[model samples]
Target: MWELRHRGAAARPGGEAASPPREGEAAGGDHETESTSDKETDIDDRYGDLDSRTDSDIPEIPPSLDRTPEILKKALSGLSSRWKNWWIRGILTLTMISLFFLIIYMGSFMLMLLVLSIQVKCFHEIITIGYRVYHSYDLPWFRTLSWYFLLCVNYFFYGETVADYFATFVQREEQLQFLIRYHRFISFALYLAGFCMFVLSLVKKHYRLQFYMFAWTHVTLLITVTQSHLVIQNLFEGMIWFLVPISSVICNDITAYIFGFFFGRTPLIKLSPKKTWEGFIGGFFSTVIFGFIAAYVLSKYQYFVCPVEYRSDVNSFVTECEPSELFQLQSYSLPPFLKAVLRRETVSMYPFQIHSIALSTFASLIGPFGGFFASGFKRAFKIKDFANTIPGHGGIMDRFDCQYLMATFVHVYITSFIRGPNPSKVLQQLLVLQPEQQLNIYKTLKTHLTEKGILQPTLKV
Candidate 1:
């Protein structure tokens, strides 16, 4: 070690000196004093006490890796150059941005797969971290199973399916039949998958067995986001579905981080110690602006870039779908290629789901809560970033936490409020019912509505 640097010193410097070198002493006699430089070199090369050993027999030297200052060091040593730090961070940011846009460009319907991927990875990190902080334990295989199952049957209670299956169900003569028929298999599948996950978690012994079961909520949230995205994708153009939520949520996240970095002063929540109240409020409002921007853009070009995926217009041909219809749907876990060809002609497509603007906004306002919630959980466990996978950014959980909850909320909202607008009675009244049947039903409703002609947008029959 330290001895390696001297190269033995013909090379030996500091030996013993009497007074000064005696007259006629070997020229090397003074070498021992010169040995201070050798000692310095040894200290530099082998991480020794050179700062203290100024007179030691070692060569003068540069600082070693351990001696390089930290971020605040201010000095620029080859051992800790700012350029290397900046270069690494820049490359990492570039990589994440590239990935973000790659998913963006892949049409929305298709990107459900990506959403699913993020959900699984992000949730896996969250759940595993809980175990790490609580018991310093690693639960590997069970976590993998949780992710796999979460991805597989997420749409059980949801009626998600390939585009065409969903389209054909809605476009056919029977509307009520469409919903009832699809839910039969899906409901069972949903419960069955849930049961399986429950059993698996118990049998495999993921840490905090009961809590692991509770973590199913994470799985549920993940599923919900996937289904929500599918609906939005189907209702609007695939692009908007991808663009709206992603732009709103991720943009807000970035904005918050940036604002917090520069302008943050007041603390928002103890859960997020570094989170600034200013940043939070700034981010929340900024998200609304982004939502408006998204809506405006999607609504503007929807006609050209997006064609309707479906419509209630009863035409056999496809038209763009609405958010309500798209979100409530639960499709089979059919592979894309198979489903694509099978559902091609039968399904509808849309230029954009303008209704999603409302839905996306709902997702936005509620979105910050998702981040807050995850932050709370992390702080409760006293864990830092989920992992160091992303250089400047935190782990997948850090990135997608908001989207998971926001997407779930939006999906649920669309299913209830936006999609199920009881248009079927209105549709039936306007269609080819038998004259007698039509007359009877019309007569019954006519008196009521006629009395209440206040309904300016009267039934069209």
Candidate 2:
């Protein structure tokens, strides 16, 4: 009977011999099996549970929708993968640039719409990545709450924009006036609702993963919506402020690619293996020169140099103002070495042209770090791109990673060195105040101006 029992135990699934216990010890076979199972479950939970698939399960080249033109496909049928990609990228770059010019011609409202669209697409791409990484698509209210938060954030930001730039228009509409008045509170309430929903949706074993995705949604919002908001703010400053910086970044990207494609030998960084020192240096010079010329051309145009403003009289936005000194050409004496090169002692250029140098320099040097950061993020997730939205460029987010960074820099630069207190914006704020408060401000300003002898002391009558 003992030999038969030993043979049956040895034939068990784990293939380990389960010998009968000796007299001094308790039979612990079942306990040992349970303990071993527990250890394996713990290991699985620690390392493999969060992701739905292991590394081997992920494909090396992410599937992308082929968007190549039919003609191009036939024309380049025999090209190698490398040269094929180069042509596709180059062609798409020019197409996007042409579309950009078309949008610029469409005016500021269209530009605002473009920014909003890009923001939504970028948010979607990032949130999609989060869902895939955590396998959280099954989580209740995940997509709903993510989109709800986006709506709330956009409401808050665009509300502030309306209150600032369209105060007159808002004041004319009773419903809008109320909404603008309670905008922040309403925004907070909307967000609080989403937060409560998220808390309610938490599952027993999914608490940690749910929190991870929750944080992921917020970070994605911060990157996409916030930076795009700044881009709009820069747009309102003037199209020149918007266009010059953006064009400089584009110019840098193109020049760098061309230089690198032809002459790249030494690698620039490991995060982006293809980036080259030759590209960096070549791009910097090209971008600076391009910015200078573009700024000069754009600064001369009132439509490009003037701040966008809502005109209640026309019930439309307008760009009409005396060009700021930054846009006006000023003469500067060249350095001794430059005098000989130019054959002139003095050169006249828009002050904004000088500022473009700083903008282009940042776009060339620091803006690329944004792309590198995106590259590292993709590597972490083992993703080749954020999405296959754009055939050759990866996605809208891929093209715009550096643009968002540039937008933030332009906003900061304008605030730090360019912008000052605006009388128009101040008046807009005052217009929304109560009559009594407006009267008080009027009296205070009158008294101050009278004391300064700027306003003829009105006769006591």
Candidate 3:
């Protein structure tokens, strides 16, 4: 009879005992089968015994609306969220408006201080970001060098402004006179010192990052300090230069948001996905119209139209000028549609308003590109906004990005078209010259005038 052996095989014909056949013997396949079955059992146990489950045991997820329209969803999305924070936004807006008027009432000096403050804040924000990125590498003197460069740049720019606008006052102060006299040389030496320090502090592996940050600091200074200086230049030209272009941008932003929220359909630019073509077009038209009206109203006030001239006699600022032709009303032929509607031959408008069209056109069309540039910079850096300084308004940089560009345009416009030589400034320079130098300039001027045929009649020794 044949029998299954548990631990040993039957003895061979020689009657010798067979070993236990190395434990598994004839049951090796069965042991492996049991092990696989145990593993399956363990898996089922861990998974809550799936073999015993039924269709009814599965829970159903609630049905959701898969067919919701994107436009409707977008419109609906912000309504609830914005209303939830409406109080904060409202308070912020009121505060901003109040602060804006307060600055206006405070005059050009305060406005200048505000511009400087904002410039410093912007510089701080950008430099801080660079520091955070590069400081981890323990690069030596990176932050110090950045701030040093800022100081050097500000010293140069502000020194020039002081010397230009407050020449009499600066010449009175011995230290100020010295600084003003050698301002460029002083600025260059300071910057060179910082540059040498940067080179000396460079580490073996951090040279590339160090140079990158060096370039970054200079660029930031150019964008923030230089542009802010231009804004101050606008301030000096007149508060209107500061106020109107800024108002245009603010108006465009408000109207654009309102238009976009209600009727924005097509995307305007990929850099700013939320920007829409409808809003852009609406804002442009609205800004142009607003610029014309603001120009009209402001033209009527010497306070708005005249330059901010410092009165050393009274130690105060003054704005007193006969309205220039630029601010005077001129007759404009009405377009056919307007003539038909109004039954008038012409309309009276300030001549500067024509220039406003250019300003407004820039504020509407090209100005937003500044914001777009800022948006790209932020995206590249993976930042949401420059900072959270102004509550709902992101940061000072965020608010002033387009203003800087507008400032540049206004400055260029004034220099190119509106500016004329100031007799007071010319006389100040003449008074500062040596006696011989002054006499030479007079003789040169007299000779040149004598050469002109028109001046020959009036020529006298």
Candidate 4:
């Protein structure tokens, strides 16, 4: 039996320790298979079971994502109705219009203060835009220096100094007469500016280059500031020197913008895609016609009707100085040129009116360049606009870019063309004449005065 079992065991692949020399394990029997099953169960129990778990780290979104749209709708529904919007808009509009008049009422002083700020803003934007366009300046010093220089420009241009300088240099009449008499200080100021810039730019050896940018910055500043100077001077001089040019520029910008937005059909240039040919045509024509009307209305046909100082003070100085039938002439030494201007001022607190027509015409024809230049600059930098400070407009630069150049034009026009060589030039010319000839002219002038009996009898001498 033992021999037979050993033979059977040898025939099997595994021993008793491996599962089965039992019933059903050896052959195929029913209850014998139960024993084999029991053995397999016991063997399985000896080893520990593994707990099941998902290996995925990503979470699947449930239907909860659908809530987003509903949330947004509910939020929007919370806002005020259309009536409220209208009320808000109306209030804002009224506020804006009132502010505009207030600014105009402040007159030249307000305009000048705003101009100084605008210049600094303009220069800095150019520098910032330049960096993006060219990738040239990367150093901190360059930026700092530029800002510093801009501040200097703002200060210099804010006062009478700049206009005084413009009179001295750029607008210097062929006859050597300046609109304002003192210009030496203005010249000195310019030199100081140049030196300051030179020294400031010396940081990090970013020297000897980019004259185009350099010139552009200075010229823009100089031009804008000088315009302010002229306008302010003319304002104080009791003239509407500023009103004409400012109005013309604003009119051009506003008209073109409105027309272009509505009916623009053809692009004026690739750089300025929105400024249409139609807008240009409309703006130009409107500006020209307006110029003529403005000229007539403002100048009152170049005839200012106003009561004279003497008329107002009929009882004051005239009555007091009627003694002895021969006056001391008030010991006045006002140069003939000054006398002429004073005489004019003496008559009116306002200036000549002809500039309105002249300005309107000039602005309509040549002022488009201001818009074009700003457009080109914006395009060059791929910026949507210079800035968003103004509502419909972009920034200080956008509003005033053309004005800068226009101021130069007007200043030049008034100083060189409109006013003619200042009445002062006549005096300068008189002073330079040969002594004998000048003496004869003087004697003739005195003789005429005496003949008119305007001269006092001075001891019959």
TM-score of every model? 0.51, 0.86, 0.78, 0.53
- Across 1-461, the per-residue lDDT of candidate 4 in tens digits comes to 34544444444335432233554444435345445544444433432131121223212211111222344346446566543333433444456447645765664456546555666676655666554443433332455555555655545444344333233232335433342333456545765876676566442223333343465556655655565555554443222455567667777776776577678898987767777888888888777667655544544421111111111223210111211111111233556788787764232212233445567767866777877787876654456666655433455677677777677777777567544333433554565456899899989989889889999655755
Best of the candidates, TM-score: 2
Q: State residue 130's C-alpha deviation in candidate 2, in Å.
A: 1.6
Cα RMSD for candidate 4? 27.3
User: Which 10 successive residues of model 2 have the least lDDT summed?
Assistant: 41-50
What order do candidates take by TM-score, descending? Answer: 2, 3, 4, 1
Residue 103 of model 2 has an lDDT of 95
lDDT of 1 at 442: 72
Summarize candidate 2's per-residue lDDT along 205-265 as a digit string, tens digits. 4567678789989999999999999999999998888999999999999999999999999
Query: What local lDDT does model 1 show for residue 258?
Result: 59
Residue 108 C-alpha lDDT in model 3: 76
Superposed by TM-score, candidate 1 places the C-alpha of residue 315 at a distance from the truth, in angstroms, of 18
Cα distance off (Å), candidate 4, residue 9: 89
Q: Give the TM-score of candidate 4.
A: 0.53
Model 3: C-alpha RMSD to truth? 18.8
Please give the CA lDDT of all the candidate structures.
0.53, 0.86, 0.77, 0.53
By lDDT, who's the top model here?
A: 2
